[model samples]
Target chain A: MDIKNMQEAELKAAIKKVMQDNFGLSDIADDADFIKDLKIDSITRMELLLKLEDEFGVRVEDNDAQNMLSVDATAQLLKKIAG
Target chain B: MASKIVVTGLGWSTPFGCDLDQAFDALFNGKTATFRTQNINLDGLYCQVSAQIPRNEAIFPFEKWQKELPGNKASMFTIFGLEAAERALLDAKLIDQEGGYVDQNLKIGVVVGSGIGGLEDHFNTSQVILEKGANRVSAFYVPAALINLLPGHIAIRHKIKGPNQSQVAACSTGAIAIADGARMIVEGRCDIMVVGAGEASIGRLGIAGFCALRALASGYNDNPQQASRPFDKKRSGFVMGEGAGILILESEESAKRRGAKIYCEYLGAGLSNDAYHMTSPCADGAGAIAAISDALYWSKKTPNQVQYINAHATSTGLGDAAEMSAIKFIFGDCIEKNSFAVSSIKGAIGHMLGAAGSVEAVATILSLHKQKLLPTINLEEPDEFAYHNDKLINLVPNNGIEASLDCVMSTSFGFGGHNVALVFGRY
Candidate 1:
């Protein structure tokens, strides 16, 4: 449950699980753009961010949340916040 | 006569299944769809019986829709509405095999409604607001809770670029939507209309709310099938039902131009308000009488001309009695002489709330087409009021009957005293 102690691979897996649960996208690539590749609109993007905040037990600011457009970026942001 | 509005196709996602003929067959054979609720948790609720769509059988194409829209985030009613609309379009031969419109030039509109729009979604969103916070609410909450979104999503999927509207007249919503769709075509606003209603509010909150109103059937939780007994002496209350019914209405000229098979001519529609009670019909059944009279007047048919009546008898004692009184007032000697048959499919499929009227309209049109009067199942012993002047009015109790039919009427009475009567005749 603690994202702070989780490995990079584990964090990515967790993020992919969330994406799969929300959007039914099981083959989400780590570097795929949320909007362009996955077609997650702004509203769905906000919902996904909220889910991530809940899952990782952290807060995401508006500007940083907007910039977390890919699974890799989301993982990096979560790591920085966890630290 | 004015340019006719004709029904070209019909579709329904009902408790019996999506196949119209199969569902109507089940109704004709006196089968009941009511059963104890499994999907909805009803631990302390007074009414525990409901008639829900057979989800596995009536499947929606979620995968195809997910590619374009967030299908998983859409409300259940919206999904059911989409399925029904697709089936109707296919039945009407308006859509190609890939579910796209066959004719790109026709101006096709949509009008669908619901009694309580997305109550289940609203309940879930409220829980998020309570347990988590308002900021955690999903962005799809507002869109999912809106009634008009059902029609909006249908329009988006089919690329329909014409007049779109939603009716919200409680149980009369489906009938009103059909009437409004016909009006659109009559007024030259559109050539074809996909019109009906959908409802999927059979959740814990919906059941509890209706239970609080003392509007749902009870004491038959263990015998759910017999809970909806319209016109029977032991009839108590209605069983909650959920589904969608969609019909394709086209102008006669348009349908002829396309060589579409016409189901029946939409002779006329009558809409009125009781203005006496919000939930109860006027004591004299004046509202229902006026609506039926208006429809007959508009259709230019006398009471004796109607061969069958799909009565809005929702298995409730007061409602059934009031409708009988209205029918008697309108068709006095006709009832006494058994000139026409009357039946209520609610006894078989329960009251489908917003979808009830259109589904029943489908039954009515089919009765005219097939020349069959569907049975009011569970009517073992008809009530005393079902008889007039020592002659039993043909309630078509517990058995289907074949009759020569040319004209038929379907009646829908909703909460807020909304009453609608639609008359259909052979094309």
Candidate 2:
């Protein structure tokens, strides 16, 4: 739960696990765009946001959710939230 | 002259597996797929048995379609529908080996239906709203639960541009889907139509609801294989099963032009409503008789010419007898002389709800093609109605029989007394 204290590799792994388990995506690159590369449409994007909220126990605002589109961006947002 | 309709391909995702030959062989061998329900808690439910597709079966080619369409948004019925539709199109040779359309300009449409379209998904979403909150519900719930989305997804995947529709006649949905597809071609709406039904309602609520109606077999929970004994003396009620069946129906000229392998000709389809009861058939079987008679009349064939019948005998006390009464009324001398065989594949695969008629349609078409009769398993002792004047009707009990089958009819009746009879003949 301590995203601020978590290592970069651990945060990235957590994000990847959620994407793989929920979206059936595996080996997603950290910089791969969710919409462009993963083809995560609007519905799937909303689902990913809810899943992340449930996983991290944080309230993701609309603007924050938009920025948390990739593994790297999501990790950055989670660290900022934990702070 | 009306356009001649023909079935060029058939596919099904059945409890016996998806391969057409393998599933048909299992049915012919009288193999039962009903088993004790493994996924749901049966402590409070009256029925404990269901026939579900094996968990390991790769029902959806996830990797193949994920690029074009995300698999996470689809419901179980859509998943089965897509798999069956893909197999059917491939079988029709309309799709090349790489899953691309062979003739991209062909006018194709889709009509796929389901009895309880995504009840499992709706149930899950309801729980999510109750436990987590309404805001937690997934945005994909609506599309996933709509019945029309089955055909919608099919059309999107195949790029079919003609009329796209879905029928929701409960148990008769499958037969009516095929019938409507043929009508579309006959009316020059489309040259080809993908027609069929799918169902996946074996969830907790599905079982409890059917149990409340006492419409499911409960006595044979310990012996699941014998639970669905259609026309048998010990039959209690129907067993719930989940799967999908699809067929490629094309205009005769279109099929010949494409040089496709024709399975059978769609002779006629008769639709009628009992207007009798909510969940029960009329004791006189008038509605069923009308449907069968209409089908025969339109096909220009007499009862004597129909060598086999795939009945909608769901193993209920009143349903089986009602069907027999109707058959006697329509096929009068044929039943007494044992000239035609009647069998219900529900004995082997249980009742597939909306998918039953189309699955049985596939079986009937195959029977005409192979000149073989499928068997009704678990019919250890025939019910009294299966006989008249000490001569028993050929129920094709326990084992498959070889026969010269040219014309065959498949009948389906739903809870609302909707009846549809489809007649097919060898091409």
Interface RMSD per candidate: 2.3, 2.7
List ranges where model 1 is wrong by over 4 Å. Answer: B57-72
Tens-digit lDDT track of model 2 for A1-83: 55767899998999888878777889999999988898878888888888888888887889888887788998988888877
Q: Candidate 1: what's its TM-score on chain B?
A: 0.96
lDDT of 2 by residue, B182-252 (tens): 88898887889999999989989888889999999969989999999999999999999988999999999
Each candidate's lDDT (Cα)? Answer: 0.87, 0.87
Q: What TM-score fits each model? A: 0.96, 0.96
Computed on C-alpha atoms, the DockQ of candidate 2 is: 0.49
Q: Looking at model 1 chain B, which ten-residue stretch has the lowest summed lDDT?
A: B56-65
Task: Quote the positional error of residue B346 for candidate 1 in Å.
Answer: 0.6
Model 2 score (lDDT): 0.87
Q: Where is the poorest 10-residue window by lDDT in model 2 chain B?
A: B59-68
lDDT by residue for model 1 over B40-111, one digit each (tens)?
678988899898776563434545556545534678888778878888998899987545754668978999
Give the candidate number with the greatest DockQ: 1
